[model samples]
Target chain A: MINRHKNLREKKGNFWEERLGLRAIINFLRQKKVPLSEHTIWLYTGSLILLFLAVQVITGIVLALYYKPTVAEAHASVRRIMTEIPLGWIIRSVHFWSATGMIATVFVHMISIWLLKSYRRPRELTWMTGVFLLIITLGFGFSGYLLPWDSLSLAATKVGTDIPRVIPLIGGWISKFLRGGEDVGADTLTRFYLFHICLLPLMIFLLIGFHIFLIQKLGISHPLKYEMRGIKVPEIPFWPDFVLREARVWLIALGVLITVAIFFPRSLGPQADLMAPTPAGIKPEWYFLFLFQTLKLFPSQIIFISGETLAILIILLFLGLFFFLPLIDNQPARKKGKIITAISVIIIIYAIAMTIWSLFE
Target chain B: MKFKYSCLSRRRFLSWLGGGWLATFVCSLIYPLFKAITPPYREPDEVVLLIKEVIELQPNSVKYFSWGIKPGILKRNDDGQLIAFVGVCTHLDCNVQYLPEKRKFFCACHEGWYDENGLNIAGPPPKPLRRLFVYEESDHLIIRREEKA
Candidate 1:
């Protein structure tokens, strides 16, 4: 049978060879294991992120068909789509909430992986790529929010873009680049539209491709405790068992998306009037709420150093630690999951508390 | 390695079923986006009034109909003459309404009002109501744009 298969492979070359390649792949999957534990549920977070991303891509592309990116046309076009187009509101709402959903799943997925200590050893690049994905996803959010050109979106965007200006040396340049000059205007719209629809999408797609490739290359990591105990655990086949489970979860997520869209259709605020005083209660989208609130808490200056600058720099420092996590946790003589656990706990608490505080405030 | 998958597992069947639903959802979503991209419909150039007869329209009565995407009103005064006006309030472009009780067209936005003659009476409407050409042809009233009103 092997000889016959080899002969057919030789005769048909690459095409037939590919047909016979399934067994090798199947055997690899069959040999591979993702250990089952009480913690196995967290494994679905990555797939959930992928599913939400699929939602964003589909709805976003559809939205692009009707959305005009220019300052004059943008708000009216969104209004036109909502009022005139058939079920366009639902698509827009789904796109909006799905973005929130995507960011959330990313947060959960990152924190879960960190708590699991999955960034150890061979998964270092996976973590790095994931960090990139997280940042790009936020980039997606910030840029997309301004596309509607609403009063509230405009106010929040001003606050968001102003953050990079506090970075000192390249601060003004970064702000200028983001806003396309001195301030947010028509040029800012064009720049953000390019970033939202063009550059950020490209970057996230590449990063996601690399991240998933790495995940598959080095299969899902078991918790540190699982490794420490040297306990043998049975794992189901990745192709059928795990994939079907993921599919089931995706269905649930879809139902959730539909429910949210039906009950809470996203609203378009009045067109941005830059000449008017900014609205009093304008806040950034929920994902940025934590940072938004943190910045709000800063004093004007701490002993001549801008307190806002200090707060931003401190956050950047933590981000740096997260970026170089694999080296810090894995490269040393002693593998330090304990330090990771402590940091993860602090980050989670800070994020949730700040998020809730921002909501109330 | 030999492969044997003669039996269809329950999970596999469920996955396929769920996958089928997702595929349907995606298609339903994408088709509408495609449909929405077409040029927004314009109402016929001339809206021939089929619902009400000119005889049925008593003096001081109002009739409303859509002209393309714009809202229009045909107000018949005590003289039994028809006066047609675009219902858009000039201030913020909100749709104005015929408030026969007040004997004026009232804009809820900024409390702007136009008198029965389509002249701005109260508040922030900078211009008078726009007039549309109205003529009766063979027992049917048709509305068309006046080239210069």
Candidate 2:
């Protein structure tokens, strides 16, 4: 049997030879196994989130083919997709929902890791990189919002772009660059499209590589408290163990996204009427509604300053605090403290409250 | 020495055989898994409409006809011949109107202009008005409008 198999391999030649080479890589991976059990499900969660991001990139590229970036052409192009292009609606819908999915998964991944205290010790850099990734993901959503160039999109863009305008001396300049001029125009759409499709994705790819490399290097973190039994924790290779679980989660996520896309394909309201009065009930995407509502909750003027400006300041300050959290909360012990728990509860309450406010407002 | 060599080679062969199966399984699963998650595309049918009777639509006369999801407009030219165009303008795609005094299909959006024949004459219009497939069907006007593909 051995002789016959060897002869068959010889007949197959280089293709079989390549397979032989992969054996060495597989052996290396096997030797570096970090213990994975059902308890450490967060690892699989992170992997699933990355998988969704990959899906987003692939669908985004396909949608870009039919999407136009010019202000004059943008809305018309979207209409063409609905009316003329083959399967154009499906392509656009996938791109739309996948973006929402990517952000949703990222948020879940972040909160799970934070709750698990997986960001402590060796994983501090991982946590920081994730924070950066979250900001970039939001940037992706914001820039992509204006591509449709309809009334709601335009209003949302105006409200969103204004958030960055509270950065003191640089606020006006940043808004100008973001809008590609004084207001949303041909240059604005083109700039946003380039950023959304090119710059942000490139950054995400590089950061994701680093993120994965760090995960492999550091190995999966065990649950906050776990004891090794006498028989030793049964270890499984990540390729099959963690990956198979991730595939199941991905399938479920895909099913939900498709159901939503088919039932509620992203809408295209009337072409943006600049001369007409701003439409009522204007709001941002669901994810950002919390912040939008928070901004609205403020008084017309806070200490003689515009409410919008003050709200912007508060958001920036919160972001600044998030970025420097590792440095600020550097404790030698891995145990959670009262301070961290209190802060976490406050954040949860604030997010929930703002979300409810947004719905009502 | 020969015995030792054979043992090492056997182990290597088994490792290679196992690795080959695993790689094939993973690669095959990934492609279909990705495809299953992707949204499927469906093409809509194309529609065309034609004019049958020249209703002496006076200059600047606006009449709405069911085209697709939206309505289309029919206006009489200064020559008093029935000239029909999609009410949706090519520029920014706002529904347009025939300003009888203006003698053109005037888009309220950015004030885009179109001539009697629906040729965009001014403003940011990149193309002429999309001409509907119009024809006479047994003395009645028949328009061919493409369905969503």
Error of 2 at A118 (Å): 1.1
Backbone-clash count (model 1): 0
In terms of TM-score, which candidate is strongest?
A: 1
Per-residue CA lDDT of model 1 for A1-361, tens digit only, reads 9999999878776675576777787777776677788888999998899889988988888788888989999999999879888778888999999999999999989888777777888899999999999999999999999999999989988888888888879988999999998899999998999999889989988999999888778887876675777877668778778887888899789889889987999999999988978988888888988888888899989998999999999888889998998878873224455766776789889989999998997
TM-score of each: 0.73, 0.67
DockQ of 1: 0.24
> Cα lDDT for residue A235, model 1?
82
- Which of the CAPRI classes, incorrect, acceptable, medium or high, describes model 2? incorrect
lDDT of 2 at A292: 83
**What is candidate 2's lDDT per residue for A57-151, written digit by digit as tens?**
76676666667888778899888776666566766776788888888878878777765566767788887888989989999999988888888
lDDT accuracy of residue B89 in candidate 2: 79
